[model samples]
Target: MNSSRGVLELPPVVGRFVDGVGTFLADDVDEGRPIRCRFLWSAITPTSCRWEQAFSTYGGRGWETNWVMEFTRTGRDCTNNG
Candidate 1:
């Protein structure tokens, strides 16, 4: 998403940072069926990072990657107003 918005479905549930990987787990419903959601984020470099969103229908036993994105910072100065 190239925007910021509020998502109550994904509450602020912090996960313990281990081995440079940060994860967030939450429960969600899909098509009236219960499912597990996981958001994984890891740093690939100082200016780049990888993020993925996966879902587990097998009671958190296995996860299937549903979405993924690589964020690489551009050369433009984002902090500048000019």
Candidate 2:
């Protein structure tokens, strides 16, 4: 993830990813406080997608979105690795 600050390095998140949607969860410490983090990914198109990060105070309940990112193709074809 990239922000005005810089790239972000997230901890090891574990979850399931199926089709064009994915949900990842992890436990992290923010500002010396323990919290639960969630990262969701959704595919909009072959060349576009959406990603967001949220925080939960109690497990998976009551989530507050902290960041969101949208990605689009930049004229770089990735259909073929050749």
TM-score for all predictions? 0.77, 0.73
What is residue 2's positional error in candidate 1, in angstroms? 17
Model 1 lDDT tens row, 1-82: 2134554455345565679888888887787788888888888688899999998999789999999999998878878854
- The CA lDDT of each predicted structure is 0.81, 0.86
What's the number of clashes in each of the models?
0, 0
Worst 10 residues of 2 by lDDT: 73-82
For candidate 1, what is the TM-score? 0.77
**Candidate 2 global lDDT:** 0.86
Best by TM-score: 1
